[model samples]
Target: MSIEFYEEYIESNKAIIYKICRAYTHSKLEFDDYFQEVCLQLWKSKEAYNHQSKLSTWVYRVTLNTCLSIIKSEKREVDTVEINESFDHHSDLEDTEAQERLNTLYMGIRQLKKADRAIIVLYLEDKSYQEIAEIIGISMSNVGVKINRIKQQLKDSIVWKSLI
Candidate 1:
């Protein structure tokens, strides 16, 4: 792909990349690094995209693979970081509550195994089972099974946290 096409592709999929990076990284610095690395990897592998799957699918696969590899190389356990440490004091109560819920969910997600984390993130992003299977290289039925199990785990985690 030409530079122009690649730039357009990145623009279109930037949110997906950002969400994946945030799901994998603990700090803004790590998120920035992973985002850059994912973009670079996409550019380097541009020619290898054989049009066999949707561009979004390819992007998800690449971003997830890149993040997983980075975590593996670092050999450090993934830890949860407060997504936005400086809360906006002027925000509405409802908005603050929503943000807190999201942060709690993300913290739970971060504690999951790398593969489960990827699956749940994709599911949350509204990717269909087929799309998730394509990105994750799992059978569609397996996607359903994993998602159900992951949901239960997250639910259990949240419930356990509430009891503490």
Candidate 2:
């Protein structure tokens, strides 16, 4: 596809890219790095898409594979980066607290196995279990079970936030 067409796709899909990037990122740089890797992989794998599945399914499959490769190759553990006050642009002070909670939530999500993490991301993005299963090549029941477990795990992790 031409650059213009790809650019349009990127714009339309920015939310998916950004949220998935956040789910896997350890730092701001890692966000950009993984996103670029996903874009590259998408372009490279474009020829491999068989058209049997939807375009969104193909993108999710490619993105998840790229993220899993990064996770395994880096062997990186879950760690939140130090908050850079300079990057703080919240309009209301109350919103900063919400941001912290969201950051922690994502960090907890990041601790999950890659498969679990993918399910959680798709779940939080309000994707149906059928869609998630189709994209990840899993049974719908598996996706349903995993999302419930991931939600419980996340709730369990929130007990110690006052200490942080």
Candidate 3:
């Protein structure tokens, strides 16, 4: 693909890309790094997309796979880089209860297994089970079962957080 086309694609999918980065990265610097890498990988793998699914689904697959690969690599860093900018950009900051739930939910998600995290991210994005299965390369029935388990695990984690 041409540079202009790739740039346009990234611009159009910025929100989705950023959301994946935020979910998988622990720090702003890491998020930025992941975002750059995903964009590069997306462009590199553009030809592999055979139109078997929606373009967004292909993007999600690439993004998630890139993240998982980064996390699994031996050269991955353990120490997080601190960012100068605060990441408290919640849109509905005035709603305290909702904010707390959102925070707790993110905390719970961070503790999940990598594959489970991918599944839940898609679930939260309101992707259909079949779409998620396609992105994650799982069967639809397995996606349903895993989602149920992951949801229960998230609830347990959130409840535990409330106690503390």
Candidate 4:
């Protein structure tokens, strides 16, 4: 791929790239580092694009695999956090409530195994079962099963939290 093509690709898909970075890294520093590494890997692996899947799917596969490899090599501790993204347009109370719920949901997700976390993140991003299976190298049926189980686990966690 030409440099122009790679630059344009990164520009257009920056959000997905950043989302993967955020999902994997706990701190701002780590996020920055991971984002750079992902970009570098994408550039270096440009020749590996086989057109078997959409470019976005290929990007996801690359990003997730890169993150998994880094995590394994570093053996870094996973940090569980309450996610807080600001929406200034919303009323203060509504924003607070939304943020809290999102945080709780993310916290529950953080409890899952790494593989489950990757699957659920793709599902949340509205990727189809087939696409998710392709990216994660799992069967479509397995994707459905894992998503159902993960949803139930999240619900159970919420209920358990509420009772406490």
Candidate 5:
């Protein structure tokens, strides 16, 4: 890679890789291993990185694949943090609420099948349905249909659990 391109990747992708690592592992050791694995995967896929998809989309795809390939993750410790362009810290109370929501979100995501989780993560991160469909190799209408079905399934499962 050119110096400029390498620097660009460093500037934009460092934190993304870290977040993916934390999302996929619970311990510092596992985080280090997975972080390296993700970086290696990203490096290997550099030639295949098409500009047609957003950079973050590509990163998420690689990260998910790496996580799925890992054999020993029984517990996941990551939160669904929303990144805003304005960089608002929000209040500590809001952070607590966000963390709670994130826990719920992760639990809900864990309830999904591999395919469903991909769509949900992308949707939660505010990707356009068209972009998400393209990234996941599905049709646009299928994306909406899958999301609706997953939402219903989640609702039903939650309601059923309360009865127990």
Candidate 6:
């Protein structure tokens, strides 16, 4: 693909790329690095894309695979910092509350096994079971089952954290 097309493609899919990167990395530095790596991988594999799947679906697969590989190679445990500490103290009550909820959810997501994290993030992005199965290489029925189980796991984690 031409450089222009690649740039446009990345821009169009930036949101999903950032979301996947954030799901994998806790710190901003790590997020930036992971995002770069995902983009690089996408560019390198551009010629290999055979149009068997939608461009978005191909991007999802590449992003998830790149993140999973990076985490596996590094073998570093995610840091367990207080989620609120990363937020601004001056935000109003409503904004703070919303940020806290989002942070809590992300914290819960980070605690999951990598594969489960990928599944949940895609599900949260409103991907259909068929699309998720296509991206994750699982059966459609299996995606539904895994999604239900992952939802319960996240709920339990959030509730358990609140009790602490």
Ranking by lDDT: 6, 1, 4, 3, 2, 5
Lowest summed lDDT window (length 10), candidate 1: 82-91
State which candidate, 4 or 6, has the greater TM-score: 6
- How many Å off is the CA of 73 in candidate 1? 1.6
Per-residue C-alpha lDDT of model 3 across residues 1-164, encoded as one tens digit per residue? 57676766677767667767666776677778888899889888888989877888878888888988888784654332322233433234777777766656766776787788889989998999988898888999999999999999989877876797
Tens-digit per-residue lDDT, 6-120, candidate 5 = 5655347665555444444444676678777877777778879878867877887787688777633544323332221111111133576676555444455555666676677
Compared with the true structure, what per-residue lDDT tens digits does model 2 show for residues 13-82? 6667767776776676777788889888887777798889777667777887888788789886544433
Q: Tell me the tens digit of each residue's lDDT in model 6 across 1-164.
A: 46786666688888778778887887777887898899889989888899988988989999999998898889866534444434222223477678888778888888787888889999999999999998998999999999999999989989999999
Model 4 local distance difference test score: 0.77
**lDDT comparison, 3 vs 6, better candidate:** 6
lDDT of each: 0.81, 0.73, 0.77, 0.77, 0.63, 0.82
RMSD of each: 3.9, 3.8, 4.0, 4.3, 7.3, 3.8
Candidate 3 residue-wise lDDT at 79: 31
TM-score of each: 0.85, 0.81, 0.81, 0.79, 0.64, 0.86
lDDT of 3 at 74: 47
- Kindly list the per-residue Cα lDDT of model 4 for residues 94-119, writing each as its tens digit: 56778777656666776677888889
Best by lDDT: 6
Candidate 4 backbone collisions, by pair: none
**Error at 100, model 3, angstroms:** 3.9
Candidate 3, residue 70: how far the Cα is off, in Å? 0.9
What does the lDDT read for residue 158 in candidate 3? 72
Local error of candidate 5 at residue 119 (angstroms): 0.7
Clash pairs, model 3 backbone: none
